[model samples]
Target: MVNYASGEAKGELSGAEYRRYSRHLLLPGFTPESQRKLRSAKVAVVGAGGLGSPILQYLAAAGVGSLTVIDADLVDSSNLQRQVIHSEAAVGTPKVASAAHAVHALNQAVHVREVPEVLTPANALATLAGHDLVLDGTDNFPTRYLVSDACEILNVPLIWGSILAFDGQVAVFFGDEGRGVTYRDVHPRPPEPGEVPSCSEAGVLGPLVGVIGSTMAMEALKVLTGLGSPLYGRIQLYSALTGDWTRLDVARRAGRAPVTEIEDLVETCGFPAVEASGAAPVRAEVLSPAEALREAATGRLLIDIREESEAAEGMLPHAVNIPKTQLMEFARGERAGVGPLSEVGDLHGAILHCAGGARSAAAQAELAALGISVANMAGGYVASVTLRP
Candidate 1:
């Protein structure tokens, strides 16, 4: 039988630790024993952003013996809104480094390991191995699916949290024990790329991450110490607007094949693949920001597909703000020649750009299929501004 509650041998708490965790020690079911289990626990947290900020802080404060923080992105000024672990000084630095510093500052005794690389199929298993528990705070579907599959294969408990707009969701998936369901049990397949707007497009409430991350952290303590029931086979959902939390049960899919290996999900969860009919792949005509700007100078129209809020910050010299939804509706004929693009004749040869270009690329693909010829500004507005002379 697999021992789900324990891992490495427990360690004795020091005087300072006892003082530091006196509140935890005083709980009836939780005493020195539980604190010792925590002291011996090793945890890996992927994506030290909004959710990760609180999860790492609470876990480190609770004295998780070792923590591995993995992320490849650098801190941006925009992240300061919800990613509380990083400060103004951390801008432009690696997220893992910033997160590690925060963890150490909170509790110097807790050992922190920083993996400053994007977790990939080649490295997910090796990077995640040896950790007793893994918390996924990554924002994208591809990374979320990757982490879940890796954890399922490793037989480690995974606490997953997602936040968007005024809502959030948290779930615990334990493939080897405690209800025996993985993330795939709830989400059999990823949604089509761009089907669900990102937090960037949808916009999230800042403190919403705190509520979800703290819940995940609380669930982590329960799983580590066996102090309470974890959210196995169920997901907890939170709504900031409604001020309510709801729980929904999830069951393992019957006859679902187990994840034996990690594979790149870029095609599955990110970009679309070629059709089986051997039709030409629908790829966007891409041009670098600088190249697109030169074309725009000559007469090619440049359209900013980012939301109005994002465009408010800045935009290209001669770009017209047409949000992705409005432009796509016009392309698909959903707007019936009545939307923002209705007045603009001849979309052919025009260029579409977003914050970093991913959305615009997706929009370009759909638009191309509908016979709307357009180009995608490869680096989008951010890159265009940087290269603008």
Candidate 2:
């Protein structure tokens, strides 16, 4: 844990640092003292994708002393759309390594620790400990929860940001500090699987990641240097399409228990759906893409739960388009087979698919809980086409 107490010896700024951070030092309240704080601060950044790109870049440029970059994915060509930190040459390289190299290039004075592994409950605490602050740029629900929980248990200050489809949100959580707000205070539980589309499915504006990531980085500097009011207990929301920004206040839930331990939520918040309650767990039936096609040929209804935008491109031969959000609404009894699914009365024994099959597979539990007897097409449309016989 970082010693937040005052009167700690401040680090001295070098002649080059003075020249580099001249603008920051010139700020009214941000003096050489603040610059020194930044120089001495250590921050842990989770993820090296879209949001992580800008956060790492800005923070590194600002001269943060040590950065621990954690990510497990390799750079894919598809990531070039919004992940600005990595270059065409970085494709197939580990994201953390690429991020570390980018950081070193941006500010050689800053130390970069690259952790090329997924942050799991088993290692999250040990990995994040000792940093003055932690930032979460991860895309999934499970990692978001895990990071927040680890911060809570470790009593670290945390800044979190998320982006989806031209929209972004930023919030600061200081577990056991100040207002004591945590991410769980804002999101009581992860959204149900497949209720929301991922960036791959829904698509996001490239600049929106910058807007949110930079905002988070700004909040981090403020927290580190006491420059201004941090966004603690407040969440900033931005919409690129509308060019609008809004703020929401978050309060710690009264009587909510503080997180004492991390729990494995791979099934609940990962690809699989939340388990159904009963004498036995109701699991979604999963079928390979080939099997799904075969089943579809045998009169089983095939549904493609990708967004309308994606379905506009193409879909399986026998698959009906019933966007995931709308399908979940129907599963939750919000509507009675409205819209494109209006004519499809029964979902029983239907085979659901998405572009890569994860989204449709994630919808399994909810549909299964309703006794719909649906099977998810593992690996989705891509596999269906590639593996077709």
- TM-score of each candidate? 0.83, 0.78
Off by over 4 Å in 2: 1-10, 177-179, 272-279, 282-353, 356-358, 370-389
lDDT of 1 by residue, 1-389 (tens): 11122223455777877899999988989989888888888899999999999999999888788888988777877789999999999988888888888878788777788888989999999999999999999888888989999998999999999999999999999888434898888888887756776776677899999999999999999999998789998999899999998999999999887888887776566455423123566544678887898898898889998888888988788788988888877766666553235543567778888876668867776776666667777546654543555
Worst 10 residues of 1 by lDDT: 1-10
lDDT of 2 by residue, 1-389 (tens): 11122212355777877899999988899888888888788899999999899999999898787888999777876678889999999987888888888888788777788888889988999999999999999987888999999999989999999999888999999878424899989889877666776776677888889899999999999999997899988999898989899999989999888898997765666456435445356555778777888888887888888888888987777778988888888877787865445533477678888876558767777666655567877657754654443
What lDDT score goes with residue 316 in model 1?
A: 87
lDDT of 1: 0.82
Off by over 4 Å in 1: 1-11, 177-179, 274-278, 282-303, 307-309, 316-322, 325-351, 356-358, 371-389
Candidate 1 lDDT at 109 equals 73
How does model 2 score by TM-score? 0.78
- Per-candidate Cα lDDT values, in order, are 0.82, 0.81
Could you say which candidate leads in lDDT? 1
